[model samples]
Target: MWRRFTTVVGRVIPGAGSRCRKRGWVTPVTVVILGLSFLWTGTLADSNTPRQSVLRVLAWPGYADDDWVQAFEKRFHAKVEVTIVDSDEALWAQMHSAVPPPFDVLAANTAEIARYAQAGMLSPLDLTKIPNRRWQQPFFQRLSDIRGLVNAGHAYAIPFTWSSMGLIYDRKQFAVAPSSMRVMWDPRYRGKVLDFNSAQHNFSFAALALGYPDPFHLTPGQMRDVARELVNLRRNLLTYYTLPEEATALFVQHHAALMFGNYGTQQVEQLRKAGVDVGYVMPDEGALAWLDCWAITRNASNLDLAHQWLDYMQEPEIGKQLTQREGLANTMMPVPGGASDAGPKLVWLQLVENIGQREALWQRIESGDRLRTFPQ
Candidate 1:
């Protein structure tokens, strides 16, 4: 029998300083000068027509695979349609548009769950309807206890998958494993590193590696420092990547020595399956861990059916399938074989002070702009 899911509890408190502040961390003048650009305008394919008796899902790549979806549809006697997303910004745009949201159920991280809950785009889950949650680890059952799963006495999301963003390196390059995050910036790895293209995560990781006290809340001076740090990283990087598959192809073709693992072990699995000799490590600076959950939309046409999907996913067999096929850690059961969740210290994601500012700064960095280009 498989062990119970790991009950690692590190939920941050609400109304804490770490939550995104109402006033921007930096001066409004500074944000205005940066001229933030909101570029996520991609539309879902065939979202116009409403499917009859279908359970529409919007989730990340592996969450709604054909194998498990077919299983769920067969079990519930309902047709399943999925829309995949690469980022939280994209997920927000989809649900925010349709009142009875275009999709009934979707997966999102804690920070995003908080945002959607605040926007009133998500629905409170009826735990009584999801009895399978009894099989979930205690940490997950106490949804209100988690940092972002509950708001104003309502359960907004169900913890489903969890993993840490760590370093993935080429094993052939180093017989002994490296222990520090600095390897990504080492001079020896010049033009051999692949970095994620996201503004929020890159800035946070840079802050972590630089020993910043709080990676999520950077002062203007710290922001400038992180910006310069990323510019240096850009000089050494072969290219920045977004999707896991894209990273895999780049790693193989470019012979990348180091990469910031965004999809966590999922990326590691993909690379290994492609026959690449690579190793993953959580550096001394610690790794950022993201917990993604399944949530219902406020306008879901089939509320009961949506709850069934969440309940079914929490099953041991389905959770096992998630790990074996997608290379993702499932919250419904312990990591197979009594593996410990202990590793690099796990930094639970929190609301940033100013995501717009980070996005603006990131656009500049990606465009190859010098740090001096933006006004101080």
Candidate 2:
């Protein structure tokens, strides 16, 4: 369950064109479809004393691999059982709905944690039993720091891997390289662009185009303005959704121009090697970042083992390995120190529950009240 880091590269600012940034507040109905909260109620972790059996976990694709599972078993004399979830939101419904939540450990992200905490569906972390706790970077010192926008700061959650959200594009698409954000909406590139279907990413992209703050603090009007811009993006778009595998295929085989790339540089390298001329740009507007961490359920079956796993993950050796192998940029993968960014704590605001304050912004986008972009 470890990933690697290649190198640090630079980022560019993107563009906004035509009537994109000039419209009404997006309505809330569409939000319903995309706004399900993550509810993790499983018993992957059970027992306070050492156990001989395996621990069950509902995590993402990478965590379920055999080699990773075997390694943990060998180290602690306990086996690991894992399940793969389609989305963070899906994991949420499964945990909260079932009584005695079947899984003990749930792979979680920053935004999802805050919602779970608010809902009272989680348990506090006990650091005393976990041996791997000492290795964590200062970033995960407290749940609030790693979870950031997600409010379950203390008593719940431990950091695992983290990264920023930004643009991934085909390299051969442009000659001189369009580094600025403005190029994304160029009339010439119409119909060649592919956008992520996520509201957070979409609105964040628009907010950046408007010279708004990074991890934008959307006001009633600012958020509305962002929704207007994305709806208009419907006209010139080739693909208006988020699919990593599909994006890869579209870029290489179908000539798509761009899509939201999570994690970081690896996405760019993957496309380039697959015979697509792909690349990524961080953008001057900065971008939404995230940490996919591990958390214990309120009624975990194996409290001791879960705590042990939490500490194990913190060890620099284990954490670094996961980051490099999984292509996840945990809390330690940043600029070596407490490096600074230009705006509001990009570190702190990475995860946002845009459901409340940004409701109007999302509504207009869903109803197409201000949209006019891409192919109609």
Candidate 3:
């Protein structure tokens, strides 16, 4: 039995030609529907029934599709149960819901991989089994060079897809591309800027715009300063958005002039498809990027099968399909005119000093917390 949990939500943002509604604090709600279970039946005697290996997969929406899972099941004669998660908080909760963890494998960013590795929830990979990794670009081949991926001399995850959180501007709003992240804070664009509704990325990028040397690790004073800066950003935002589609809708409907491209190129593609003339640029302070990878659980029921799943994702054809379908940059090949290729600079995501602290403060800020409430 293959079960998939999916989230379906109505178009929350108004249409492009709709009247601009008064800007206020908007919290998007996600409705999760239990999709019908797919049962594969075959002719067999009850006594001769064969046990099919079950591979439980936890991934982001676009990472795992029905066609891909169906192909894997057909090739290996296994049952794949996929679970989709929209946020890191939900992913962490699902992983910890069971003793051995509910899923056999998961797709997470480098920072989340480090967090899982520290908790001993992930198993080290045997690169020998994933031979297709050789087809990856030179930058991805050297795993050790990337932080949060290799710990204690063991590789915990394999690179899959990545993009930098750069700046997205409406071409009609700006004669030249915005060169700095500070553009989002410009008073001229007040109530016309869109920012991702993420605690970690918001704090990290705020630090970058403030000329902080290290974004992941911040001093107590630095944290307070970043929080205050975010308060200023809140005043300029039309509203915070959670998904790329939502951001696109808000951008078009509100006639937004600028946005922090949290989804990076993926958001850019979505906006373009929506008939918006948008240009993406990496700010001078550098963009915070995320590299999503596949990692096997520490207590995987089928170790070989989990490894095969990782290898399957690395196949050149599979990578191409993912890129074409999702507008994501796959590791197997170079992205044509991609931001990561010969860009300003990319600060690969790393484990932050204190995720708990960031989240608590972000909650307050996003809820319309006043500037005086923040630390000095």
Candidate 4:
């Protein structure tokens, strides 16, 4: 059951930050939870303190894998209920709306956190209850050092996995596929290209191509320039798939020449098992970096159990399982003694939070107005 759950949550793979843009989806009341059992049917909490058996979590497909819930319940002696978010927008709507804090914790990326904190939807860290907080990493330390980090100037969330966006491709097809973002738009491979699942990714990739240092810092003119280019690519695109696994599948089935994927090497291997040939590369300009964290939601009924669950996950053994099951990298620990480097890119992406530019760029891309890359 847990493996089945992982399979679903694994789809989100990696993307987004702390607060997801709410413009995308109009959330439904009945959140579809994976890895669900009788775990959340009843309330199991200690009267003296907050003891919760059922935990409501809004996560992408595989974040609530049954294995995780079963392990957590067995170790902490509690039940957890998970809701699989349909899209990034939907998960964030749950965070900002008048909706109650349905889940005890969120396995969301860091970029999305700032939005949640600003909306007064998220709470500060109750670090005392969690043991993982004690095993902090230096990389995380530097991130927190940045002045005025979202949640009340304190990190309410704990970093779990870390990755940057890079290219994963097929070796058999491109004996010499360059890491440059231009390859996706190259006319020689025109209709064979597939792009990243998000607008930020789309525009940022173009920004890099246009020689911009930061995608988020683009001026209006630069944005328009990139938008036109995106629109053109959309026209030539085979399909715009959001799932990491799906991106990999495009290559496995020979439906696409290249895809915008940063991690999930397991898919590459799986494709190989089925006789698909592929490889991954990070372009010279670079890719985006992402951090997935575990945070407690305000009003979460089983806060204490959630903290315990976090502690259990921080344990190397459990963290290892998470990394193995999902292709994303974790911040809790360094890559084990011997691990492959087929993760995402090395450069941190300039995340776009501005709604106006974001929408315009995506619209232009979808409209096929200016994109033209495959220099013939």
TM-scores for every predicted model? 0.82, 0.72, 0.89, 0.76
Clashing pairs in 1: 5-333, 5-334
lDDT top scorer: 3
Best-to-worst lDDT order? 3, 1, 4, 2
Residue 62, model 1, lDDT: 78
Model 1 TM-score, all chains together? 0.82
Off by more than 4 A, model 4 = 1-52, 96-98, 134-136, 141-143, 146-152, 262-275, 332-345, 349-353, 360-364, 367-376
lDDT of 3: 0.82
Superposed by TM-score, candidate 2 places the C-alpha of residue 319 at a distance from the truth, in angstroms, of 3.5
Q: Using alpha carbons, what is the TM-score of model 2? A: 0.72
User: What lDDT score is found at residue 35 in candidate 3?
Assistant: 22
Cand. 4 Cα-lDDT: 0.59
Instruction: Kindly list the per-residue Cα lDDT of model 2 for residues 60-128, writing each as its tens digit.
Output: 545444555656677877766565553444466567657877777877776677677677767787657
**Off by more than 4 A, model 3:** 1-23, 30-48, 335-344
As for TM-score, the candidate ahead, 2 or 4, is 4
Superposed by TM-score, candidate 1 places the C-alpha of residue 180 at a distance from the truth, in angstroms, of 1.9
**Number of clashes found in candidate 3:** 0
Which candidate number would show the highest TM-score if scored against the true structure? 3
Candidate 1 has an lDDT of: 0.76
Which lDDT tens digits does candidate 3 get at residues 117-139? 99999999998999988889877
